[model samples]
Target: MNALTLASASVKSRPLHATLCVLAAGAGIALLCAIFLLSGAVERSFIRNAQGIDVVVGAKGSPLQLVLSTVYAADVPNGNIEADQAKRIEHDPRVAKAIPLALGDNHNGYRIVGTTPDYLSLYDASFAQGKVFEKPFDAVAGALTHLKTGDSFLGAHGLAADSDDIHHYHAYTITGVLKPTGTVLDRLILTQVESVQQLHAHPDLGDPDAAEDLKISHEVTALLLKMKSPLSIMSMPRQLNKTSNMLAANPGYEMARFSRSMGFGKEVLTALGAGFVALSALMLLSALASSLAARRYDLGVLRVLGASPFTLSCTVIAEGMMLSLAGAVFGILAGHGMAYLVAVNIDSLQGLVLPQSFLHFGALDGALLGMGAVTGLVAGLVPAVSAARTDIAGILARGRA
Candidate 1:
């Protein structure tokens, strides 16, 4: 038989052991691939949420929290910046646009954001149904929002899926639903800033200056700032922190800081994954070496039947490659399937949407698959050498004995 046929028969002879070797390698690859997909998705989510904003202006607090809340809608707002402060920033020569956000209250777990229609452009979002909110109590829903256009519901006091304190008296009607952008906006409820202000307004509620200009009485959770020039990054945030009551946070800088803190743990996990891969490679080597020992007599017979020593070596190597191929393919599928399952479950329970980012194979994935082949090559090398150098006379004599 040819080398490939011989290799196939040899592997088939020990199907259970071959499968075990593949599974060991596959398990390591699955862990590594899943981690990569999750990390990549999270990083992309952060970047997408921060797109087009040069700085975030909010109350003095954790800059990361402010960005996470205002940008990603994943946390509570630190505090509010006055309406006049947001307006002043809007008028700054260096500022191109300042999209204000007023948050608090949720419709079945989705955050209700009070912002102008300009907010849609920040994400390059388009209308999937109906139109933008034009008046108080009118809402433009996110793609994932439970409410459809023309539907109405009273929002709860806090951003909880089920909160006890409901705004039972007045109802907000959904005016539009945004096309899914896969950003924070995908799950948020958008309305005019007035709608948010009205929700907080009551005869008994306290305010520092309740009688102030009704417009000035409004307060926003944050300002999504755009600059006229890239150079403004240096001056804008510094000026805001020094002169204004609001704190200015650079989302890019904050994300980088977050990445640094997360990087060490990421490295540790990666090293652990590499270790597993190495261990599996060793297992494959050991299994193949033992198989080669058992098959010495059979391979010697093939040598007598006109098969070259090179053919025997190649046959053993082919067996190793077949194992690696099976492992790599299975591992890739398992990793993505795990990601898909997590995404669906997370959306159903917590509403934190994690898309199947692993489905898109990139250089990282290619390298991961390549690593399997390299492992096979390393594992197969010693066995192939031994097969090439096998003592045909000795094996045959021992077999006859």
Candidate 2:
């Protein structure tokens, strides 16, 4: 018989042992794959959010908190800064662009950001319907907001749909709706800074045209600043912290430190997974060694049928590799399935959107299959060598005696 037929027969003869090796290796690969997918997605999201904005200037607080709040919109602001203070930074020679973030009100849990039209340029946003906010109380909805241009919604006092403080007096008109950009902006409600000032100043609204005279405090929650040059980071951050009362944070640095802090647990899990893979190799070796003892007579008969020593050795090795291939394939599928479920739940509750690449496996996954095959080949080596040296003539003579 050919080597393929021999290898198939060997695995078919011992199903339980084969399954044990596959399951162990599969579990290890599954955990690793899931980690790879999740980490890549998270890193990409952070990097994308921090693009263009070099410095985050806000009231003195946790630097990490400032970065998270301004960049990711996942945290509360660190107190407000004077509108004049932010404008001073905007006109500074070292600053390229400055977008003031005025955050407070929300509609049905979606945050309403009070900023100028320049904020839309940060995400390269284009209107899918209508134009930008032209008048007070006029709003531009995100693509995911499910609101059309003419639709009007009451703004909640806080960032919660179920918030107790609801502004029943005023209804904000959606003058525009942004196209889906796959960024955090897809979940926000954008309106003129004047609209937010009006929302807080007047609780009881009358007419849109008549309310233009009302005024509120000139304060912003934070400032997103971009530098004119790479060299500006060193002097500007220090100056902002030392000379000014506000805090400045570098998102890239904060994110790396945060990732390092979170990495300890992931490293431990990886070590455990490696332990399982090693155990799988051991089990495969033992199973192959044990099988050789019982299969010597069959192997000798094959040798008598004109199969060479090398062919017999390769057959045993192929059987082990086949088991590895099965395990690797199973592990990859299981890992991605878990990631998909997780991404779905996160999107449903949290506004963080994972990219299309997160759901797809790349070259590393294919490399895992090859790695598994190598593992099996190493485990089956000693047993294959023993099988190749089987005494054909002696076994036949003894059986006939």
What TM-score against the true fold does each predicted structure earn? 0.92, 0.87
Superposing all C-alpha atoms, what RMSD in Å does each candidate have to the true structure?
2.9, 4.1
Give candidate 1 misplaced runs (Cα > 4 Å). Answer: 203-217, 347-354
Model 2 worst lDDT window (10 residues): 207-216
lDDT per model vs. reference: 0.82, 0.79
- Candidate No. with top TM-score: 1
Residue-by-residue lDDT tens digits, candidate 1, 84-164: 878888899999889999887788889988899999998888998899888998899888776788998987766788886
Score candidate 2 by TM-score against the native: 0.87
TM-score of 1: 0.92
Leading candidate by lDDT: 1
At residue 316, candidate 2 shows an lDDT of 80
